[model samples]
Target: MIRIMERIALDDDELHEDFMRSSGAGGQNVNKVETAVQLRFDVRGSPNLPEGVRGRLERLAGRRLTKDGVLVLTAQRFRTQERNRADALERLVEMVREAAVPPPPPRRPTRPTLGSKKRRLEGKRIRGDVKAMRGRVEGD
Candidate 1:
């Protein structure tokens, strides 16, 4: 089981991992070894996550999420498959941890204060007067 937060723990079975060949910097070993790890988690179908967390996870995943609400994370930063696998799982745990936090309250709409409004209008009037003074004098 993976603990995402104080209240959230995910079973190992919830995650699916696939290993594939890693590109770059491995030389001869890179072609023969499948060091890259791809981790998939079904956010929509998970029984472990709260509804709010599920929704936030989907939103935060963005392009990494599929239409079916599966989140795909790839980790290939390490040369060894074990390291990459751990990295992928770590990323998934971090994402779930982030999702566990409640979203901030929605911003309340507010109108400008009377004093601020008055100041804005006063500034505009001053700007207008300055521009008006640039015009040619009628009597000249």
Candidate 2:
């Protein structure tokens, strides 16, 4: 099981990984060995994820998720396949963990504090005075 949040765990089968030749930096080995990793998770069809969590994941996935609801992560920063694979999993875990939390509740309307009201009125008065100063001088 893949641990996301404290109570949330994703099944191993829900994730798919593929490896391909990594480009740049490693020279000959980079050309021969498959060091890049691609990880895909089907957020919509997964039985491991709850409906609410899946919905949140879809919204949070942004460009990583495909139209069919597959979340794809590519890891090519590392030279080795194992390290790249680990990096991919870490990213997936972080994304799901972030998706697990609900957004904060909206704030309720409240009356301004007495001090705040006074400060606002003072600011308005100052602005008014500045504007009044710009008016044409009387009889001049």
Error of 2 at 128 (Å): 10
- lDDT (10s digit) by residue, model 1, range 55-137: 99999999999999999999999999999999999888888888888978999999999999999999999999999899877
- Residue pairs that clash (backbone atoms under 3 angstroms), model 2: none
> lDDT by residue for model 2 over 3-97, one digit each (tens)?
88877898888999999998879989998999999999999988877777788889999999999999999999989999999999999999888
The runs of at least 3 residues in candidate 1 whose Cα sits more than 4 Å from the true structure, single-residue gaps closed, are 110-140
TM-score of each: 0.77, 0.80
- The backbone clash count of each candidate, in order, is 0, 0
Give the candidate number with the greatest TM-score. Answer: 2
Model 1 C-alpha RMSD vs. true structure (Å) is 3.1
In TM-score terms, candidate 2 sits at 0.80
lDDT of 1 at 94: 88
C-alpha positional error of residue 59 in candidate 1 after TM-score superposition, expressed in Å: 0.8
